[model samples]
Target: MTNINNIQSISQILDSQSTKKSKSSGPAQGFESLLNSVLEKTQESEQGIQATELGEIPAMDFDIQTVSSIVTDKTDKLLTSLESYAYKLDDGNITLKEIEPMLEELNADAASLLEETLSLGEDDQSLIDIARSTAVTAKTEYLKFQRGDYL
Candidate 1:
């Protein structure tokens, strides 16, 4: 009876030890391999980024002369239209209703011209100033006309 009890106790100790070894080694080995693979992928991506950084970037060529001309042309048109409108207002035959849409259009053009002026060179400043003043004058005349001050 004593020998049988001792054999059973020894068997239990062996079973517990084997279970502990499996629990410790199985997932740890798998996790270590996963971490190593992730590090390798990161290193590959870093090398690819460094290669791109060493490559030459292409230059962009553009001309502002055409753009400046367009702005100038638009500004000229705005000034012409405003001058014509001022003459029409002075003639006093056109009504506020008739002038509304035309004034609105001129105002829109003036605003666009003003925005374009910001991108223009220093030499075009006088043209910008003229457009600005013309717009303001037109607006003032329109207000006066609305208030019956012209009559």
Candidate 2:
């Protein structure tokens, strides 16, 4: 009976030792390999990014003269239309009702053109104020005409 009890104790000790060794050794190899693979991939990606950026060209600057000429052409057309409308109004060929819608449309177009012509970082306050005033005047005249003030 004493010999059997000693053999059972030895077996239990050996089993616990084996369990501890397996638990420690099992995850160590897998974790080391995973960490090495992640580091290698990160290094490779950084090299690729640096190479791509070095191969890229710088952007060219835009031509200001070309842009200015285009803007001048558009402004000329808008002014011509506005002048023609004014003449028609003065000659009494067109009523306020007819001119009001056209003036509103022209005002909107002129405002858009002015914004586009004035690039970023430039002030266009005066031009915008003039456009707003013209729009208000046109609206007031239209309202007056509608109320039978023109007749």
Candidate 3:
């Protein structure tokens, strides 16, 4: 009876020790290997992005510069149109009726430019606002001339 009891106790101890070893062996190494693989893949993705993104970065900047150039051209056109409109209004030889159509076209062009400027990013918004205000001022001055109360 004493021998049988000792054998059962030894069997239980061995069973518990085997379970602990299995727990430390199977899932723990698997999880560590998975983590290492994920880290390796992430590093590979970062390296690939670094290789491919340099050209893309410059092209994006070029597009922004192109838009800025167009905005500058429109700004020049708007200022010139306003100047000509005011000049014709102040001239004594030219009749107001003849120049009115030209002023209207200039106003339309300015409005179109304003719409284009508004499409730009926050970096360009201040310029867009100024252009809009300038257009309004031109329109107001033209109306003032039409009323014979030019100031």
Candidate 4:
């Protein structure tokens, strides 16, 4: 009872034809192409990240007050080390076991202070000299203690 001219054919109904041409810049059409594109983009992003990470760091400038504070801190550490030794020595019953560590600490602190103060202005010459002398004194005291002089 159907009219033949109005009836659609099975082949026409299942046709896969495109009305327009695909652009070259359109999404990749195959699995291999898609995977390759993803890999290329990832490599590009990674290169950008690497360039940023490997960039040179800028130099820092320390002002006079900052430098002075650093030097003063080192000097304070040296003085504290010397004071600890003095207190232990004044304790009147100090043993070699106690003095050994204190002497080493005083020696280290004095050496560091001397090194730091060496770069200061001529106004700090006295401080530099004091640091040097303290270092020497600490070394000598340590040597004497090691030789059983205080035993």
Against the true structure, what is each candidate's TM-score?
Answer: 0.46, 0.36, 0.49, 0.49
Q: How far is candidate 1 from the true structure (C-alpha RMSD, Å)?
A: 11.5
Taking the tens digit of each residue's C-alpha lDDT, what string does model 4 give over 67-150? 456677776776677777778877878876967877777767766766777677887676666666766777777778778877
Q: Tens digits of per-residue lDDT for model 1 on 127-146?
A: 66776676666666656656
TM-score of 1: 0.46
Off by over 4 Å in 4: 1-67
TM-score, candidate 2, is 0.36
What Cα-based lDDT does every candidate model obtain? 0.74, 0.64, 0.75, 0.68
Candidate 3 residue 22 C-alpha distance from true site, Å: 72
Error of 4 at 39 (Å): 26
What order do candidates take by TM-score, descending?
Answer: 3, 4, 1, 2
**Number of clashes found in candidate 2:** 0
Alpha carbon lDDT at 6, candidate 4: 41
Model 3 weakest lDDT span, ten residues long: 51-60
- In model 3, which residue pairs have backbone atoms overlapping below 3 Å? none
Alpha-carbon deviation at 54 in model 1, angstroms: 40
TM-score for candidate 4, residues paired by index: 0.49
Q: For model 2, what is the error of residue 17's alpha carbon versus the real structure, in angstroms, after optimal superposition?
A: 58
